[model samples]
Structures are given as structure tokens and as C-alpha cells.
Target: MLRPAFLAMLLAGISPHVLAQPATETVPLLREIKNWVTGCDNLRNCHALSSPSGVDEEDYSSLTLHIFHQAGPEGYLRLRFDHRGEDLDLSTLLLDGQPLGQALTRDLHVELDDEGGDPEMHFYSVIEDAPARRWLQRLRNGQRLQLPGDDNAKVSLSGLSASLLLMDAVQGRVDNVTALARPGKAAASEVPARQPTPVLRKFPTAPALTAQEQAGLAAAAIKALTNTDTEMKPDAEAGALSADQAMMVVRTDCAAYNCEYEISSRERKPPYTETLLSIQPLPLDGAAFEGSVGYDETTGTLSYFYKLRGIGDCGAGGVWVFDGKAFQLREFKMMPRCTGSPYGDWPALWTTLPAP
Candidate 1:
């Protein structure tokens, strides 16, 4: 015969083997997913998350880098950098938690290669896993990571990328970092704790727009950044305009966007022309069009180019607009940035932004 208390204790000891199977499988699978650079850029705005690349930060020497887990396709990773830009399109630009749409900035380029198999298992199981393991023991908690790691990463802006991430996002902004995991989850270490990043919250104190126009612009910009489409009711253009109209005005008015517009028809101060063509997407298909608009503040004429027929690495000179709202095809011209280079912003434009 045995004491009842002793028998109960003996039975409890035998339960140890009951819960050890899943933990064995969970650890190894996460360790083999591997790491790869889905995209790499050493240029400014590499990730295109509204943070201007090539542009230095508000005179600060420290640079920020962001690494995203999945990009282009599922199971891949992408790393990019952002610095800054100016008078930005609201539909696409974002920095940290705010919007710095029109600040001149730089874009940083990055490069990467990976030897497959998760580096995560190496980091978590061997090092960081111990602390969480210690914490997990007290509560007898076996969380399954019921939640997924994800962010929307999209907004309605057309002028800039909606969101961005970097591999080096650690040093600059890591306070918002938080992570949740399960017992023996090997990938737990790579799951960075949520960090508070700096972004433009207060819109710049620029010249003001009317309430109606401002609200309309804000909404349209948000829509564009988020990629939402509107049905376009007739008065939709009256009380508030669509993203297309707001963006068109910006292109027509901006120097860079209008770079080709001034070159389309005639010669401005030379080295610039009204016949300037733009750098279109690869293959020169009309699917994603690229053109320019010109505004000569002195002349107050705003116009855009509708007919550009060439594709090459060339920069066009300035254009003289006869109209305040439309560009005349006759004024078409071109100013070559360089010879034999791809038709695009200077490769340097692919670099980081100057200090804001």
C-alpha cells in the first residue's frame, strides 16, 4: 500500500512527457526559411517610405535604415533607405509617423546577399531565447503566436511609397519595439520590439489653401497613398477634387515633374528645351507614363507635355509656357542631362537626401 499523497506526486511526475512534441518541430522549421534581399538600393529613398534618402536628417549626422521582412513576393525580404524630398505628393510619401512630403532629402542605396536557412534560429535559440524562456516558465504560458507579424505598408499617396522598412532601423528608432512569441519560437529574436520612429506630424506652415481646397487635397492625397479609387460624382471636382487633379497641378507646377514640359516646344535659357522627353518605365510602354509640367513663376504660365516620343538617357532644358493652365505642344523641347545614361533622374537622384 502507498500513501495517497505520495501516489498523487508520482502520477504528476509522469506527466512531463505529455507536452514536448510540438516544441521540437516548431524550433527547426522557423530556422530554415532563410533570408534574402528582395530588393537593394544604395540610393536615397531606396525603400521609398517618404523618408527622403540622399537628404541628411534635420542636420543630424545619424542616418536611418529600414528592413522589411516580406517584399514583392511572399517569403522574401527587402531592405531600403529613405532621406527626404520636397513639395511631395501626398498620395505616397510618409516618414515615421508623420508626413514630410515636400522636404528636399536624399535616398540611400543598399546591397545584400543571403546564404539560405534561417539565421533566426541561430540568434534566438542560442541567445535571446533564454530570457523569454525564463519569463515563460513563471506563467506556464505556451502562446502559439496567435497573431501574425504585419503592417498595412500602404497608403493612398501617389507621389511617394506608402511605407518603408530598413535592416538598420535598429540604431535610430527602436523605442517602440515590442515582440510577442511562444515557448521555443526560434524566429522570436528577429521580431524587433515596436519602436517609435520620427515622422512629420505637423504639416509645414506654408502658404495656406482655402478650407475646402485644403480638405479636398488632404483627402485625395490620403486616398492616393492608400490606393483607394473613387466613383467621381460630378461635383466631386467642385467641393473636393480627385487625386488625379491635385497631382496634375503638382506635376504642372513642380520643376522636377515638369522637367520635360519646359523642353517640349522651344528653347529656354539653352541646355533646356520644350522638346524634352522623359525617362519612362522600362520597355517604353504607355502602361506607366512619365512626363513633365512647367511653371515659370515669373511668367505665371503653367503647362504640361502630352506628346513625348523618344526614350533614352537624356535631360531636357526649360520650357516657356504661354498658358497658365495648359502646355502647348509647340513649346516641346529637350535638354540632355548626359549621354548614354539611362533616361532618368541622375543616378545620384537614386542616392540619399540632403540634411533636412
Candidate 2:
């Protein structure tokens, strides 16, 4: 007779198989679903926002809705509304021109939190899961989501359902009771497990350089840059990386509008032995063609920001940390459409957790 443990294993092999989580490495993704844009991070956290393209410039009265959903059984769904104009009549918000009534306005727990200190008081509110779900149910059949007392501030509901469905798919919640778009009797345990955030080990910053040494290093890097392009000037920044290593950021082109910058690493003293550094995800096509790059001496971090327009409502940005010997990307985010969303609220295309 088989041992008890061996018998249990043999019996378990005959039982029905359960859904398993994906084993492949996860990458960040961004998708445009009609009037909405949704993105997911490496950890499977997803964000959905109203399309910035739908609002015209100078439309301050327009309200924006942002949704966030995390992965796993303990994940939560959060909804926030941002309004930058006059005090809104929350009761007047309508679905297909019918009032949403006082119930939702109260459930939203609306509050004016001008955390950014913009000139105008921006209305910020967070809706609880139950109420947010009810709102979604009501929105499913509506064509327009209209703001109270503002005819010009209406959001198209065309793509919201598709966006939520995409979010559910990304988090492996489809057919599970926790699904946002379509809830089924499938157990939540069947949903895929949340991916772990990557950790980065950052190196301590190098010793500070004297003013004279900084100027010399900056000049050497500038000479290397100017050798490639005659029009380059003294607009360059330099910082120490180690006892004998240094980094230099030079402005390559900025005749008009947005500026262009390039980064290079080299030896601290004469001969320089400079090598140009290439940034990943490349820069967006318009606005600043090559984008802007900079270094922070205190943190030993290099950063880049690319704007699609002068207003900076949309674009991409990234951060890299020096690991003593080389730079490693720590985070990256992008907002492809020029929606008037805050730069810090952009969707993450890449992310890494810091070492504890």
C-alpha cells in the first residue's frame, strides 16, 4: 500500500486543474479605447483617464475623471474627479441628460483639495468602491456624461466600457467576481497573482568637486560636444560620478521653442575619453525632438523629460540611477495625448521599487 502522502499526491493529480497566473515577464502597456486611454504597469496596476484630446484649449470648465485599479485579490478600485473652474453643482451631473441626483453627489465624498496650489481652487473628490461601481453601471447605457450647469463640459462615454474591460483583462480579472466590466461567478482566487515590483540598488553619490575642477570637466565635455556640432555653445552641466568618473549634459539644439539636450560620461581629468549616452524609449516625435536630459549630483540620478507641446500637458519622462559602474533605468512614464492631466499623474511605462 502507498504511503498516506503518496496517496494524497496521486489523488490530487486526478483533480481538475485551476487557472494559473502568467509566468512571462510583464511589460508596461498603453492602449487607446475610443474616448478613453488606459495603461497598465509592470506590476499590473492599471489607470484609465478621460482623453485629453477631447478637450479644447481654454476649456477650464471641463472636468476630468481618473480611475485606478490594482492587481490581485486585495486590489482596490479608486476614482477621482478634478475640476479647475467655478464651484460645480454636483447634483446637476447627468447621464444622457437625466440628473444623477443627490445620492451620487453625496456618495462621491466630494471635497475641494487644492493640493497643487493652482491659482484656481481645483475640486478633488474620491468615490468609494460601492458608489463608483453603481456609477459605472449607470454610465454603461449613457452616451454623454454631462457636468452640472456647464454645457461645454461634457465627456463622451463611448469608450469607458471598453477601457474598463481592458483594465480587467490586464489584471487577469475577467470572468472573476472582482471584474469591473463584467462580473461572473468565477472565484476571485482564479485571478492571476500580482507581479512583484523590481528593486533597484542605487549607488551613493561621488564626492563633490571644486569649482575649478567642475569648470574644467564641463569645458572638456563641451569641447567633445562642439566637435560633433559647430553650433553648440557653453550651455552644459557637469557633475562628479566617482573619484575619476564624471558626467556632462550639453544643450545640443534650442534655437526655438523646446530645447534639446544630450548626456555624456567621461574621465574626470585631461584626455576626458568622453562617451555619449543614449536614452531609451527614444523621445516623442514632435515638440522637443531630442528631448532634455539632466543630472542631479546629490542623488546620483539622471533624468529626461519630453513634452509634446509647450503647455506640457502631455509627454514622457524617465529616471535612471548610477549603480557605481553604470546607469540603470528605475522608472518611466508617458502621457501620449495632450489631456490637461498633471505631469506627475502620467501612466507608468516602466517602474522599479527601491531597495529597502
Candidate 3:
């Protein structure tokens, strides 16, 4: 028999499990003509998104579509329309000249004119099951989408073929999934083989702030408290301020997590104003103002960090970078678990911040 030390060494050399750890890969954003966009996540899921040009003369009028694909060769589609001043009652979806019978109304929120005098309406629909597949086919081959409104108002849809093609290529590249089925033909079956999972890379920790940076943050925090746009209304019931009173003074102190500020009126009255801004000591959803906020000189970015309540060690926050005139929010990410797209948590996941 082998010696005890030799046996211990042999056991130490071998791993207990045969499976390797999952690895994550960063997939860059893909853009195509007419502003179509597609991307994939570490889990190999892919999505295609686009906003079609509006029929209305107003520049703000728009309609957006998003398609998502999972590994089971399954997928779904979402369509949204923003009608700020007009009432929209979309009852049907027509591809070319054929009406998709499977279409179902998902949601409708109408703001009456009498309530606020400013009417706003929104329409949303989620297409899945057979209807989603049928819509995909029609988009690949059809030339027009007809939405018959009152008095025979016709809305035109174009550029769908090119958009779907880009999405198909992206899904195929990332998930090895495809939805391009020929007319009157069934889609091919997906293989049962599993794709290799990727390991997730960690983001580097931000460095400590300098004295000058701390001062700057304190100043910004004070200004943020006094700005008219900021919500600084005092609660009379809480005895913080009288009903007619307003904030007349603001002071701030900077810490690693955030800058705490105090607001008061000229009288130095009772129930003084005390609040937290910029950052919070812990990560919690919907508590943006309570997160840790700081400036990173290396990246010229204002970063905020907060805890993602249910997700351990996975942080959620946003980053704002300074433009020529003012700071603008560029990116926000919430990673609950490390398996899916980093930017897939919300609609319009990535935005272009305007310069002040």
C-alpha cells in the first residue's frame, strides 16, 4: 500500500468536480443602416431593437420595436408607440394585406383631457406564440403595415426586411438561433447541444477622492439642493417649515459614499432640514439619491454605487460623464445575476445624454 503522505498528495492534486467554471464574454453593440441596433449578452441571448420613423410631422412622434431570443429557439416581440398629444386606438395589426388574427390587445393608458388638460396616450403589445412567428415572416416579405384609423387614415411601415435581417444575423452569431422561416414552411429544429458558459469579469474598484474633488462635490451637492428643479419642498406637518416658508440656506459635507446636506430658512427656526444626497451607504433599488456618488478623474465620470437588495455582491448604479457644458448620464447597469445581458434590465437601456 502507498504511504499516507503520498495518498494525501495524490488526492490534493485532483479536483473534486469535473465541470469547469462558467466564463463571460463582452459582446460589443452592433449597429446597422437606418439606426437599427442588435447585441448579445454573456448568456448567449440576443436582441434586436429599432425605432421606425414617425408618420407625423412632429419630430417627437415615434414607434419602437424590440425582439428578444433565448436558447430554446424561442423568442418574443414588443411594440410601443408614444402619442403625447393625440389619442390612439390601435385595434388590429395587418401585415401586407392579411390581418393577423392572433393579435391581442395588451395594455392601454389614456389620460383624459379634462383631468390635466394635456392629453397623453400610450399603446403596448407583446407578441409571442404563433402570432410572433407569423409576424416575423410577414416582416421579412411584406411591403406595408396598415393601421386603419377613423376616416380611413393610413399609416405606412417600411424598412422591416432590412431590420429583421440584421437581427437574424446577430441572433445566429450569438445564440446560434434563427427565426427565418420560408412561407408555408416550418422552422428547423434546434440542436440539443448546450453552448459553453463564460465566466464574468469583475469591474475595478474606484479610487478615493482628492481634497479638491471633495470640495467640488460638496459645492455641487449644495447647488443641487437649492436648484428650483430639485424637489426641496418642506413638510409643514413635520414642522420642518411653515406652509409659506422656503429654503434660504444650504450646507453640505462630503464623505466617501455621498455628500450630506442641510437646508434651512433665514430665521434658524425649529425642525431644521436634514437630508442625504449623492450616495447611500447601502445598495437598494429605487434609492438612487441614497447611493454612494463620486467623481472619477481618470474617466471623467460621476459614478454611483448601490446595493442590489436580493443580489449579493452584484451592484446596481449609473454613470454620468461631463460634457463640454454640463454632466450627463451616459450609462446605468443593474446585474441581478451574472447570466444575462448587462443592459437588458430596462427599456432604452442605453441612452445618449444631451449636452447642456
Candidate 4:
């Protein structure tokens, strides 16, 4: 007596529970396990990171261990826990059933402790020390970590040997440096000597410019300042003038890149005429020129100093010599600005051309 379409709609609205079956528990998919990973920084500092295996998504989000080595033969380890909405108070650490006496807690939210807010916790220990060396030995032999509230639960320390190897490689230490420490003895002193820092190479100076060559270089400087593409020669008819007889002035507009300059010259003769000899653009690959060009008439050494704007005390400069036919780049140096301290002025760490 019912319409076919209506009957079909009624059946579709029925719940399967009407014919009940036994309830089944939901099972979570297993996550890919990453035991430990190693990496290095631009300055060659090395780090090793790891997390516990078999940890669910919720539990793995808040826990990790990190080992770091700076530009030295020493290393350090850190255990991090994100306690954003949970309570965590670490008082002890254990490596392979042996307690780490030197483990200290660093709470980033110490100021917020009195305000009843959760704070992230970091437990740190230096591996170069005696206690840390013992821990490292245990990790190498049988990797395991046990925290205060873990109820004797220990996580396997996989990839620890490889991680230590990576740290040693960064420090330029040999395989012997990875030997485990003896019980009740200090092994920090057993670390191999750190490699010495390499020396910076210096550029050689060029021969002094001749009278005619000086005139050509001066003309080129004038052309560079005027942003012109004119070809200039060191011929006698190009108005050869001595350094004392001709004055050159260089100026920049402080552009980050593609900056141009104006070179004005004044001849101390007869009418004492001033002329814009050349208009040339700055080298497209170079930084902005900071101050005026320096010319040592006695040595015929012309220096061009360039600097990056907004970077404190960092600059690159070059010395050039005239070879009667053209100007030759004799020496070039680039200086890096010091950082992270009140005293920011440091000498140039490198003098070679930067890698492209």
C-alpha cells in the first residue's frame, strides 16, 4: 500500500543497530619509527636527535633528546619535554640503570611557575665531564634512557653510536676518540686534540702605475663615475696629467645594488678647467662603495672600498694598479661583521673572493 520511493527512503533512514553486533575496539595505525637523526650547521656544528619508539602520536609530540657539538672536541646532551598543558617535574635521569648525577633541570617558565602556568622543561648534561662520559659509555654499549616518572620504563638508544661518530667527525677526531670510558675513571681528557684553524691567504701587490698609465686609470675612474660606456686609452694625446696636476673625486648615492658614481676632475693649469671625464656604472656584481676612492700617487695604488648598507662594519675592498694598458685588480678582501656582542668591530676573517 506504500509508494516504492517512500519505502526506499524509510529503509535508508534505519540504523544498523537494529540488528546489533558485538562492539569492536578502534586500532590506531603504526607510525614509522625514526630512532635518531644527525645534522650539521653552516659553521660545521653537529647535532643528533632522537625520540622513543612505539610512542603514539599524542605521546611523541612532547618528548625528544638532542646531542650537540660546537666547533670543538666537546659535546653536550639535552632532553626536552613540552609541558604546555601537563604537569612535569624532572629530578633525576638514568642511563642504562645508572643515575646521571649531573643532570640539571632548566625550566623556561620559572617566572610563570608562581602564576600556575605550565612550563617547558629541559634537562641538560655535558658529555665531556666524568659523569656524562659514563653515560655515553652506557649509551654506546646498551642504549637506554629512564626518566623520573617512567616507572623503570626505558627507551632503546638506537643510532647512538652513529651519532657519536658524526660528532667526532665534525671535531676532526679519529676513530680512537670513540673508545668507551673505563668505569670510575674520567675520559674527558682522552678526547683527541682539536684541529687548528686554517690560516687566511693574503693577496700580492701589483707594480706601480707609470705616468701614462696613471692618466689612463684616472680617465677610467672618471668614466666609471659618470655611468658612461666610453673607451679610454693611456695615449699621450688623452691629456696626460700627473697625480698632483689632476684631482679625482668619487661619490656614491648609497644604493644596495647597481649603484653608480660621479668622478670630477680639475686640471691645475692655465684656465683650471673642471670636467666630468667619464660616467661609468659600478661593477654589477659588487657592493655599494662606502667612501671616496683612495689614490697613493707615490705607489700608484688605487683602492676601492665597498660596503653593504645596514650591516654593521662589514665591507669588501680592492687595490688596483695601472699596467700602462689597463687597470689590474691586485688585491681584494672581504670583511665579515661580528655579531652577538657589544664589541662589534672585528677584523676581516677572510680576504678571498666570496663563492658565487
Model 2 residue pairs with clashes: 52-339
Local distance difference test scores for all models: 0.23, 0.68, 0.37, 0.38
Worst-scoring 10-residue span by lDDT in model 2: 10-19
Stretches of candidate 2 exceeding 4 Å from the true structure:
1-26, 52-61, 111-114, 226-234, 275-289
Number of the predicted model whose TM-score against the real structure is largest: 2
Q: What TM-scores do the predictions have?
A: 0.17, 0.83, 0.39, 0.32
Instruction: Kindly indicate the candidate among 2 and 4 with the higher lDDT.
Output: 2
Local error of candidate 2 at residue 92 (angstroms): 2.4
Model 1 over residues 282-320: C-alpha lDDT tens digits?
110111112444333333333333222244333322222
lDDT score for residue 343 of model 4: 13
Writing each residue's lDDT as its tens digit, candidate 4 over 1-356 gives: 32333233223312212111101201000011235444443233444555343332122423345455553445443323222223444335566667645343322222234444324433333434444455466567766666656452334576567555544544443333433222223254555443443332232333434565546545555444543443432111122224333435444343443233443444534343565333222221333333335555444445665443343233445555433323345444332222111111111211223112
Against the hidden true structure, what lDDT does model 3 obtain? 0.37
Better of 2 and 3 by TM-score: 2
The TM-score between candidate 3 and the true structure equals 0.39
Where is model 3 more than 4 Å wrong at Cα? 1-26, 41-44, 52-60, 71-87, 92-121, 149-157, 173-178, 181-213, 216-356
Arranged by TM-score with the best first, the candidates are 2, 3, 4, 1
Clashes of 3: 14
- Give model 2's clash tally: 1
